[model samples]
Structure formats: structure tokens, C-alpha cells
Target: MAESPFAWIDEQARARRRAGLVRTLRPRPADTPLLDLASNDYLGLARHPEITEAAARAARVWGGGATGSRLVTGSTELHAELERELAEFCGFESALVFSSGYAANLAAVTALAPHGSLIVSDAGNHASLIDGCRLARGATQVVAHADPEAVRKALGTHSGPAVVVSDTVFSVDGDAAPLTGLAGVCRESGAGLVVDDAHGLGVLGEGGRGAPHAAGLAGAADVVATVTLSKSFGSQGGAVLGPARVIEHLVNAARTFIFDTGLAPAAAGAALAALRLLRREPERAARARAVATELHTRLTAEGLEAVRPDAAVVSVRAPSPEQAVRWAADCREAGLAVGCFRPPSVPDGISRLRLTARADLTGGQIDRAVRVISEARR
Candidate 1:
């Protein structure tokens, strides 16, 4: 008999099961009764009537898909409009939209860090950024998490074009990067700074202008930022915001942008609508942050160890991976949905119950969520 080529997968599966790291997906229903704290809809705009109507209107007018890569036949007038508005809102000189945030990061890093250059990446950066560094032609050196001094030291050793990459707010622990410090070091070293604001787009800065803007790096010649529309915008896409020259470079050299299909029209429309709505209701940004603070305060008051959130994410430390999974299940049983983070997802190898704070959540909802989480803790 021929050898079983796929036999290793079973062994890996068994190991994962023994380690309590097995992952499974649960499809959500259209009308779920459970209160949601697992989603990234920080501003509660995903289901807003106006946003949905915009999506519908876009689909009616632009059809279902972009139909080609951006340069080929997919660059619609709507895309250009969204790009202009996004750049303006984020305080960047220009912007380019991608199919997703991951693609945007890949495009930015790989395009910016060419051969003989250096990429000083923070240890706690998102996987997308890490992958971008890996894919880029430059030499990459990862420094301590949120440590500007480490980045400075690394940049000092490289006598070439260099860029420092980090997340504005780390997703795992919900802690913010030292953006001001990092930016200062980058300026001193004559290095460009690239930040991923996936968690900061609608939860940080004045009126959610974003972390880079809040750090006064927005529209800076050497600063570039990437953001996801899926989170606060309640849509599906990503974009790179930077100087017009950088945007032009990516348009010409970024493989992801050049090769990948353009963002869907509905997502573009929905994101534009959300951006306009956010501009009108800037208070939504502060509300999301307040909700996160409240969640952290209440959880810690109940003796649950939670990292203080800088944005809308609240992470509660769990004793173990098994306990974390069981706790999340228990919370689900109690009609509250929360996120569970384990080994591979958490850089520190610590398990956690990740909770998201939505601007639309009421006081009663917050109280109930805290109670349920407390009851579910082992």
C-alpha cells in the first residue's frame, strides 16, 4: 500500500487537541439574541441604516464587484472619491485603498523597503506587518515592544534607508505604542515611520482622526499609516495613507495593489458613508473609548485581571488556555458573546478573554456584560 501522505495532519491535530489549542468557527445567525462584545464594530456603524443603504445603493449602481485589478479596469470614480475623503479625514496628503488591511500593509512595507534598506519592526506588531517585513527585500530587525530606544539603536546600526514599523495600539493587550517617542527617534535617525492603525482608526485621536494624526505625524513627509475599514468604519477594506509621492510609488511598485483585485463597491460605499457619519458624530469616538474604560474598570473591580485599554479593546487574563475557552463558552451560554485568545494569537503565550467596546452599547448592556463575564470566570 502507498504511504499516507496526509497522515501528519492527524498527528498535528492530536497535538493541538492535547494542548487545548483547537480552533473552531461558529457561524452567526442573522438575528442573534446574544449581546456582542467579540466584534470589531467599535463605533456601532456596521448595521446603521444609512451605511447599509449606501452599500445597497453602491451595489445597484456599480454592480457586485470591482471586476479587475485596480490598474486594469477596477479604478472607479467611487474608489477615487473614497480615497480622497479618507486621506482628508486622516490628515494624510494622499491615500490608496486595497482589498484588505493585510494587503495594504504588504504593499506599503514591500514597496517602501526595497533592497539594501532596513526595516526596524516592533516585536508586538500585527502579523500582517511581520509578513510584510518578511516579504520585503530589506533587512528586518525586530526590536522590543513599544521601545523607542531599541528602535533607535537598531536604526543606528543601519547606514541605509530605514523604516520603523509598529501597531498604533496592539490588538492582543490593547496597549498603545509609544508613538511620540518612536516618531522622535525616527526623525533623529532620518528614518521613515510606518504605523498600522488597525485598532486606532475609530477609537483614538481627536474625533478618531487616528493615532498618527494625534501624534502630530499625520501629513508628515516621512510617516505612513495603514488602516482597516472593517473595524470602526463597519466595512470591508484597507488603505495606505502617506505623502502623495509614496502613494504614487505604491501605485507603481506595490505588487499587492498592482496584482490584487480592487475593493468591492459595496464596501467602498459603506466605508465612505461611515466616514461621513463619523465626521458628523465625532462624539462616537470618545464614547467607544469610554465604554472600553468602563469595561476595564468593572472587570478589574470584580478582581479580574484586565489590561487597561487604550482604545476599544479590553483584554482579561485567563489562567490557562482550557479555562479561557471554557470561560468564553460559559459567557456564550449566558447570552453574552466575547472573544477568546490563546497561544498562537497571543504573543506572550498567555490566554485571554478579549472584549470589544461598542459605542452603541447602553449602560445596562455594559453592566450585564460585566456580570456575565464575572460569572463565567473560573
Candidate 2:
């Protein structure tokens, strides 16, 4: 047998093992009992009967898949309705749905800024946004994480059309970006602002309208946002919300939007149901924020280096990547499922335990989660 060109993968795998960075998937049983904090379901709607029913009903009515690209045959009435409600709820003039939030980010970045244009991205942006910057036709400058002055300086260096991209809430540290400051800088420079509100959609603003709306930038001519339906919406897919012109431009120019199939009807239905429920019971947003704050307070009080949460995510730092892996494993062994984030995923190369706070968590659950995490730390 001849050695393949991909033989270096074996060496890479060994290196990963030595660094305790080997990744694997574990299939969870439907009814397995474990305290879960790893998933991005920041709200309880994923399991809600209404949401599930909506998904099932949508699948039954719209069929299993979207059939083809949206322009061809993928668009469903359900998708339109979802987009309409989502736009109105988020206070945007228009919204365009995609297969996932990652796709939405790519569509926004790649489409909005063309050749000779500039894209000033935050250093701590999500991978999707980073990839979008890479794929975009515009030249990209990565500014310091959450530093509005850095953003201003980046924009000042260029005189042409520019767009500023950032995550409303950074994923690794669970710290929030200075949205208001960024918006002000963009406004002053006459640059467009594009926010990926994946973490903020279900935890910020009035009933989770999102970080941009909370910052009073929603529907602003120079502002845009992308959201994930899978997070607080407890569904699947993503959407880009902005002025009508921007969305129209996406429809015509964004390859990710035009080439990718439309979001599934089931996901659209579920997200719509979740949005309506959130509208009816707006306290869910506040509840999720409270849970994150409580988790941060308790963990920090125990002498753990936990970042102060600005939304529903609370991150506790580990000494090293190996320690982070071991700590998460220990927590899982103790009947608690937690998220472990390490190098490459973390731009700062700091490993940590990432936990998402859900709106539906009860007081007892919060205490249990905190105790389990604290006990596993040391």
C-alpha cells in the first residue's frame, strides 16, 4: 500500500492528543438524565409543546426540505411570515432568512462591502464573521476587541465606503462589545455598522429585540444585524435585518443568500412561534440575564475567575487547555454537562468553561449548576 498525501493528518492527530485537544462526539440519549448547560438554547422554547407542534405542523405542510434554492422554489409563506414578524419585532425595515446564522453573516459581509471598500472587524468576532471577512470582496482590518477608539481609527485610515463588523456579545469571554460606542463611531465616519447579534438576540434589549435595537441603532440607515434562530429562538437557521435597501441588495448580490437554500419551513415556524411567545411573555429575556448574573456572581464569589456576563453567557477561565478539558470532563462525570472552549476557538488562546444561561432555569437548577461547577473547579 502507498502512503497517501493526507498522511500528515496522523501526525496532526497525535499532536492534538498530546495537547489534550482531540475532539469527539458523544451521542446523547433522548431521555438520558443530565444537567445540561452546554447547548445554546438560551430559552426553554426548544422543548415547548407549542414550538414543537409548530415545527411538526410546518414540516407536514411544507414538506421535509425547501426543495431548492430560494429563488427557484424554496420560499414558503411561512418563511415570509417569519421574516415579516422578525423584522418588525427587531425594529428593522426588512429581514432576509438564511440556512444558518453563519450564512447570514457571510451574506451581509460579503455582499455589503465590495472591491475597494473597507471592513473594520472586531478582533473577538465569532468564527462566522471572521470567515465572512475573509470571503468578502472588501479589504478587512481587525480592530482591537470591543474598542470603539480602535474602530474609529480603523475607519479614519480609509476614506472610501466602509462597514464595521462586530459581535454584540463576545462568545469566549462572555463580555459585551461597546455597541453604543461603535455605533457612534460608525455614525461619525459615515460607515455602515453590521452586528452579529447571535448571543444578544435572546438576552438583550426589550424582550430580546437585540443589542443593536437596545443601542438604538436598529433600522438606522447605516446599521444591520444578523441573528440565529437556533439560540434563544430555540429553532434553526438565521436572518439578516436592516434597511430595505440593504436587504434588497442582499437578495440581488449576496452569493450566500442566492446560492444557499432557504431556511427550512419547520425552523421558520418554530422560530415564529418562539418570537410570538417571547412577545407575549417578555420577562424571559430578563430572566436569562438574571441567571447569567447569578452564575457569574456565585462562581466569582468562590474565587473562580469568571468574566462578568453582559448577556446569557458566563465564562470561567481555566489555567490551561488541558485543565479546561479535564475540568469539563470532571463536571460531566459529576452529572453536569458543561461547555469547554479552547485554543483556536478562543482568539486570546485562553481556555475556559463556557456556560449558557437559560430563561426557563429554576432557582434550584441555578444553585445546582453553580455548585456542580464550583465543586469541579478545584
Which candidate should be chosen as best, given lDDT against the real structure? 1
Candidate 2 ranges with C-alpha deviation above 4 Å: none
For every model shown, what is its TM-score relative to the native structure?
Answer: 0.99, 0.99
lDDT of 2: 0.92
Q: Write candidate 1's Cα lDDT for 84-131 as tens digits.
A: 999999999999999999999999999999999999999888999999
Which residue pairs collide in model 2, if any? none
**Please, what is the whole-model Cα lDDT of each candidate in the order they appear?**
0.96, 0.92
For each candidate, how many residue pairs have backbone atoms clashing (under 3 Å)?
A: 0, 0
> Lowest-scoring 10 consecutive residues by lDDT in candidate 2?
30-39
Over 4 Å off in model 1, which ranges?
none
Error of 2 at 229 (Å): 0.2
Tens digit of per-residue lDDT, candidate 2, span 1-378: 999999999999999999888889999988767888898999878889999999999999999899888888999999899999999999999999999999999999999889999999999999999999999989999988889999999999999999999999988887888989988999898999999999999789998889988988888889999999999999999999999999999999999889988888889899999999999989999999999999999999999999999999999999999999999999999888899999889999999999989998899988999898888887
